[model samples]
Target: MAGAFEEETNLYNRIVLGSLLPEGAWEPLPHWLQGWLRNYIGGTLVYFISSFLWCFYIYYLKRNRYIPKDAIPTNKAMLLQIAVAMKAMPFYVVLPAISEYMVEQGWTKCFASIDDVGWPTYFRNLALYLTIVEFGIYWMHRELHDIKPLYKYLHATHHIYNKQNTLSPFAGLAFHPLDGIMQALPHVMALFLVRMHFRTHIALLFIEGIWTANIHDCIHGKLWPVMGAGYHTIHHTTYRHNYGHYTIWMDWMFGTLRDPEEDEAKKM
Candidate 1:
């Protein structure tokens, strides 16, 4: 067990410190400090780059959008959302770092290469991870709503933008620090539950960052079985339905899924 632990530790050190840092840049740091720098700084850097790109794409390039132009949040509101996101960045950074350390310690599975695991195993693990995360967040989200105090203190900040165009990709992480952490708890938990390649972990996080923004773009359409911006938009507007993050299965199962189009037709 000790030998296996040492091998995994060495592998993580090489992948995280070796690849992410300049040659010799990490050598001078104390052992504890090396871990801190690699996990915290590296995690923050990845999230920052992903967040910036997604925000830029949505606000600048994706001009013709689902929400009408006039209904979009004003520049001031968007700026406030960005500011809140910045304040909440530390939670985002620290969680991934903690997860990485867990992986290194063998509390979670980690592979050095996708080839090591084979393509079929890699895909299965990815699916399993997503399911775990979605299941966790769905229940936690519903609990946040059911518990009045939790909703009032934690989840309310995210609901501030209750309209379509008022949300952007930036709004995705603009949650209160506690709320942000809660939403992300599933990702961390999934690491412990499933064996995954390091590359798969990174890919899942990257896709999640982009998907969070896409779901808030106010576009009305499902990504087939996967819930899309339209499904989430209704959640923002109604605050009573469509609570699952990536899939409609939970909401459908629990009877919280509301179809906006169908509701509109009934009103007419």
Candidate 2:
């Protein structure tokens, strides 16, 4: 584990930071600081690039088919969402940076390589890890809505985009900094409960950016069990259903799942 961590540090310094920073500039900082910088920069890039691509494809290219002309978020709303996300991004990346540092220090169940365990065991652990994260995030998110003070303060910033028309991909991360962190804490916490590939953990964290954007697009993909924009759109409007992340399993189990299909059927 120690050897792998050292190798990773060296690789990041040489390939990532080395290409971007002067030799003397970053060499003096500690390993954790370097990891944080890497996460911050990488996360910012993922947020912008993914958000723009999703927005462009949906809002520009296929706007007529995917989004309602009257329901489209105004430019001002998108800009505000972007601004809020930018302000919270540094803090949002901190959890992953800390998780990376902790994994390096051998404090987590994060394994340096999948070779340590066979493919079957690795996948089993991954399933367990995801399960823990799903359960934790569902409850955490539900409480953010159920608790009056949490909603009034931290979570309320995101509820501004409550209606379908006001929601867009940009609204994904447009959260109060602490609110975002609290929601993301489950991913990091899962590392302690089950073994996970270090690289997989990092990849999943970044995937959250894309997943959130997809959920906010307000286009129902009709992917069952998998929580698509259709389910999430209902969550935004009703506020009392579909609190599950990644999947509807938790919400279904907990009796909070609301099928978007049922709503459409009623309209018909």
Best by TM-score: 2
Give the range of the ten consecutive residues with the poorest summed lDDT in model 1. 1-10
Model 2: per-residue Cα lDDT over 178-240, one tens digit each: 999999999999988898888888889899998999999999998778999999999999999
lDDT of 1 by residue, 1-268 (tens): 3244445545556778899778988878754456556555554555566656855665567754645567566678777877887787666656665665666566776665677788999889889988898899998888888899999998999999888667766677678888877887888887778877765575566466667767776766745677887788889989899999888998999899987677678889
Poorest lDDT segment (10 consecutive residues) of candidate 2: 5-14
Candidate 2 Cα misplacement greater than 4 A, ranges: 22-24
Pairs with backbone N, CA or C atoms under 3 Å apart (clashes), candidate 2: 71-165
Write down the TM-score for model 2: 0.95
TM-score for each candidate, following the candidate numbering = 0.81, 0.95
CA RMSD, predictions in order:
3.5, 1.4
